[model samples]
Target: MAANIVFTRIDNRLVHGQVGVTWTKAVNANLLLVANDEAASDPLMQKLMSTTAESSGAGIRFFTLQHTIDIISKAADRQHIFIVVKTPQDCEKLIAGGVPIKTVNVGNMHFAQGKTEITKKVYVDADDKKALLDIAHKGVDIYIQDYPGEKKTTVDDALLSKVQ
Candidate 1:
């Protein structure tokens, strides 16, 4: 099992091969919080992800907003804690729901209509960018990186290109 969640990297792949095997080891995540509002309501989707994500070592947990907060707080002694969100708006919802957001670390948000044209890398909309800034203004460190080693993108950089 990953020792204690030190990281909460956002990967849409969720508990795929690379995520379970690679990202798990990298983050030392003991409890994996898959925090997708959509996935929470669907039992089949939850089952699939939960089953697929099962590792003999790491404990896989799927949480809706309420449960996620309970578990995260309950498991505070955990050296490393990870909470996952599928979209930036989802991130906003969690914060709005009072999850005590520490930061928003982005990964692999692709091109979409109304989104700010980030490099060839990712696309984010005004809603997403503003939500990010809101989190930042609240004093959370919003950092962006695609993988284990990439240049970190602050919310300012994300706002720079299109929002201006």
Candidate 2:
């Protein structure tokens, strides 16, 4: 990917087969920012995701949470970077480290054993929801939009906006 694709989204699944097959085309994205420390450390994980994406041409870069903070803070190029994270805590960490993202589009996060329902498509456990709310309060526009055209339920401002 080109490091310039412009979808600032997060999904625990990160860039999976669905992302490559669907969202890439839909959003016209060319750069993917995989923001996860573990993923950055694991070369195999990077290779696997790249393969899944077919590495057809899109630029995919995996970065530790801290590095991601620096990258976003300094760059505003044209490639359309899709910033991704596995959970709200990860997102929180990035921001606390000094990354200032303005919006976050949630792609997917499945319900684990004990998660609360914030919306039809959003589910957050107590601590995670708190973190998410904190991020929202900081002016990040958190939205749940699994696929293209899916109704985007806001993570802030919407009265019913609590990641369930």
Q: Number of the top candidate by TM-score? A: 2
TM match of model 1 to true structure = 0.78
Q: Candidate 1: which stretches are off by over 4 Å?
A: 1-5, 157-161
Model 2: C-alpha RMSD to truth?
3.3
How many backbone clashes does every candidate have?
A: 5, 18
Tell me model 2's lDDT, rounded to 2 decimals. Answer: 0.73
Superposed by TM-score, candidate 2 places the C-alpha of residue 120 at a distance from the truth, in angstroms, of 5.0
TM-score of each: 0.78, 0.82
Scored against the true structure, residue 108 in model 2 reaches a CA lDDT of 71
How high is the lDDT of residue 80 in model 1?
55
Candidate 2 TM-score, C-alpha based: 0.82
Cα RMSD, each candidate: 3.7, 3.3
